[model samples]
Target: MFRWAIIFAVIALVVSLFGFGGVAGMSKDFAVILLVVAVILAIVGFISRGKV
Candidate 1:
């Protein structure tokens, strides 16, 4: 999941560099969403681990 976010972020950067504004924006959004979800899941897993 985290890997995917990095991929999308890199894609966004490359796309933006080439001047594909819309595509880059979409990729950036996906990257941000994936990053948030990954962080949330990681935190949840860490907290749950402490209980067991």
Candidate 2:
């Protein structure tokens, strides 16, 4: 999931550079959402793992 976020972030950057505003904005938003989800999952995993 984190990897996918990075991929989409790169794609967003590239698209923005090429002046595709709509695509860039959407991809960037998706990348941010994925990144946030990945972080939340990681934190949850860490906390749960420590209990064992």
Model 1 regions more than 4 Å off: none
Q: How accurate is candidate 2 locally (lDDT)?
A: 0.99
| TM-scores for every candidate against the unseen true structure | 0.98, 0.96
Error of 1 at 27 (Å): 0.2
| lDDT values, one for every candidate | 1.00, 0.99
Best prediction by TM-score: 1
Residue pairs with clashing backbones, model 1: none
Candidate 2 clashing pairs?
A: none
Error of 2 at 34 (Å): 0.2
Clashes of each: 0, 0
